[model samples]
Target: MASNRPAPQGVYVPNDDDFGGYDDDSSWEEWNPTEESIRPVRGRHRVHKRGGGGLARSSTVLGVGVIAAVGAGGMATAQGGKPPVAIEMPDVSAVTDSLPEAKSLPGVGALISDGSDDSAAAGQNVAVAAAPLSAAGVSTTDAEQGTTDAGEALRARIMEQAENQQDQADDAVQKAAEEAAVKEAAAQAAAKQTAAEKKIAAEKAAAKKKAEAERLAKLAKSYTLPVASYTLTGTFGQPGSMWSSGYHTGLDFAAPTGTPIKAVHSGTIKEAGWAGAYGYRTVLELDDGTEVWFCHQSSMNVSAGQKVTTGETIGRVGATGNVTGAHLHMEVHPGGDATGVDPAAWLRGKGQSL
Candidate 1:
């Protein structure tokens, strides 16, 4: 007999337990959702039975409660200050269509395609990831090349500067050397000019001295000594008692009584007569108006108006009136005056020693 019963709202209904018991020998198998027989319909809910029986309705209720508890835990986790992220699942059908067919190997079971092409693709990806990027979004190789070029340019600039400096230094040194050479040349020229002037002056001085010597030689040829073969007896300006004056007024030449006297230079006879204290005295007047008096002469050979050349005999030496030995007294007067100069010095002016 069947009895009518009212079930509670949330309670589970159980069927009769026909199997021996839920034992440890039970076997479990994985469910294949891809199989056409087990495929679930869209927008419909259904429960499939396990082999030999269905799970107890209490067990199903307990599984639903567990799923509900897990859903509540996930909601709590979402509310605990973490934001929820949406993930998209890939289409398996599209992935399978793109892959190559599976192949069987000798030792291995069915295997997917060999990964040589995939590895090459992966290598390209790795290369892209490993490369460094610059701030301008360029590759590291290009950046390094740019750095090398810049370095080379900088080095070239430095070398150019050094070469320019060297050239400048060389120019300065060359300029200094040229300046020094110019100064040296100028100095040498000046020295040569000075030497030339000195040579010219020396030549002029020598010529003038030679001309004067020739003129003096010609003049000396026209002059002669007053008397020859005579001994010096008295000198002028000697303090003695033999003269009216306090000093000797003339030179005295001692010789033989008849020694000949000569004219000292070219002159005209002015006085040829005797005077007091001077026997046979003769006077000669030169061209320049100077007079020569020969005193104490033995005789006179020239008259008052006769001209006599140098060395011509004019008188003879004798102590006629004066109280001296055989000697001749000579006196010289400028312009035929009483005042006289030393005859020895006058004769020496005409290049005569005495």
Candidate 2:
């Protein structure tokens, strides 16, 4: 027995195994239309019928019209017949009115190449014109490295020079300080020496003044003697057997040998020598025409006619006479006269006690 039924609308039908479904609804799963359900296309997709059956025939005609219109719109967009490319406006700031002409860019010939072997030669020429970018033909990377090395060397030189200059300045300062110190020391030493010399001169002056004052004082109180003490031991004409000048011409003194005899006055020694029986006698003459005789000395100290200062030693006392004991005989002569004043009285008149 065979059962027959009407197929469902939009149902799939088999074509072959490769084209498994005739309706292909699986390929259009999102949206699908059947000839029974689809409406005729129109407007942007519209078409007019020449001659057709009914709605099916009209739907196919409308679909053809819609497809033709969409194809025409797409073709126009792809054609070069569209609006010209819009020109870009120029920026005023980028204008070159203020700048000089720029040099040609290197490798620019390559960009304008006509695909010939000569293009390489033109590019090389542009590169030669751009050689000023580097100091030598070497690349910038190598040049920059050399420049860095040179900069470091220059920095080292500058530092060395600075150090040398600093050393010189320090040496000059030290020398100046040393010279100043030496000068100051010399000045101080000179000042001290001058002060010491002044002090010594002042001391010498004071000593000289003191000596002069003492000399003047001695002169004011000075006196003269009439007879030396060594010459007279006894009075005028005393009785004694030790008479040297015949019965003691003057007087005798018994003194030790070598006792000093002094001048009686500031006079001259008139005679000084040995006398008969009055050995080693000395005579001193005065400005008043008076003469004093001393006898019996051990030695005479002054020469005859020599100037004798007052109280100066003329001889030594002794007993060198025609006598028994050592003694001196003294005599005074007024103008060499045999008759003379008493030696004792003459000593008193001259402010001396015999």
Candidate 3:
């Protein structure tokens, strides 16, 4: 196709700057387009998803349209000298092909190389040019989104890392608290168990002591005092020299003469005869072979070999022989031994008190 713009019947010619900086006006005389001008791009450029997928046809159409528009603008500048309309190409979607070839108006072979002939290096160059912004370490997504803020991605990463660290620290503290709670519970359980065991032991000891006391109380029933209504004048082991022995070997119960004397415990009459200093002495032998002597008696109520019970009348208090006043003397001999022991203490052992 041919486009002719003849100057309006005037003898004026267009300037060189209006026709791709050509100094000779003859060079801009007439121009026509050829099929060779439409260069067939060998490789395809990948556009962003938001952009349409027709890279070859679109890019070809776009390049040809830009040259046509610039050519018209040059014509305007040469003819009327009006300020060339502002020719700014808005930002386009991302590309992944070699760089866009530098283009000028058609028929202006003086400016750019003839890329109508393609090669591997040129193709690589185009691919580099068409490569996404991400290939140059820029965020293609953000760039495509028209993001203007810098360091936003870096700030997001730092915040994410800090949050992770805080979460880990919280988990560690919670675990430690749980462990501490478990340990405290175990300690409390141990203390409770120890207290329960101690209480059980104390209860057992108390029961045992009560049982022993009950046993002792039962044993005191069988024993009685030798003579009631009599005053205790001399205890066993007294140091009075009024008797033949150096110390008093008997417990003296002072009483009026003829007062009744009772048997101390259930026993048989072993001896009911007199000793010279002992007055009318009576000896009783128990089933356990212990002997109790009752002396200074005015009269005996039972004969030898006779059985008697506790508290039964056996004799009368008297100072019949070698005595100054009426009284009764008592002695105890265990297992029929000739020597006697402290009757008061022995009675206490059997749960009896003086």
Candidate of highest TM-score? 3
Off by over 4 Å in 1: 1-209, 233-249, 277-279, 320-324, 351-354
Collision count for each candidate, in order: 0, 3, 11
Q: What is the C-alpha RMSD of each candidate to the true structure, in Å?
A: 25.3, 26.4, 22.3
Least lDDT summed over 10 consecutive residues: which range in candidate 1? 14-23
| Candidate 1 C-alpha error for residue 135, in Å | 20
Clashing residue pairs for model 1: none
Q: Please list the residue runs of candidate 2 whose C-alpha ends up more than 4 Å from where it truly belongs after superposition.
A: 1-233, 239-247
Order of candidate numbers by lDDT, starting with the best: 3, 1, 2
All candidates in order of TM-score, best leading:
3, 1, 2
lDDT of 3 by residue, 153-201 (tens): 4555578799999999999999999999999999999999999999998
lDDT of each residue in 194-268, candidate 2, tens digit only:
999899888888888777556544542343442334445577766656554434456556667776777777788
Model 1 root-mean-square deviation: 25.3
Please give, for residues 1-354, the per-residue lDDT of candidate 1 as tens digits: 322232223333323332222123323444434345555444445445566345577688877775675566542222234333333568999999987544444422222334566876667656555544333343355456564344555565678899999999999999999999999999999999999999999999999878766765666677776678878888989997777887889888888988999998898998998788888899999999999999998888989899999889998988887646889898999988898999888776676766
- Winner on TM-score (2 vs 3): 3
Give per-residue lDDT, candidate 3, residue 12. 39
Candidate 2 Cα lDDT to native: 0.65
Better of 1 and 3 by TM-score: 3
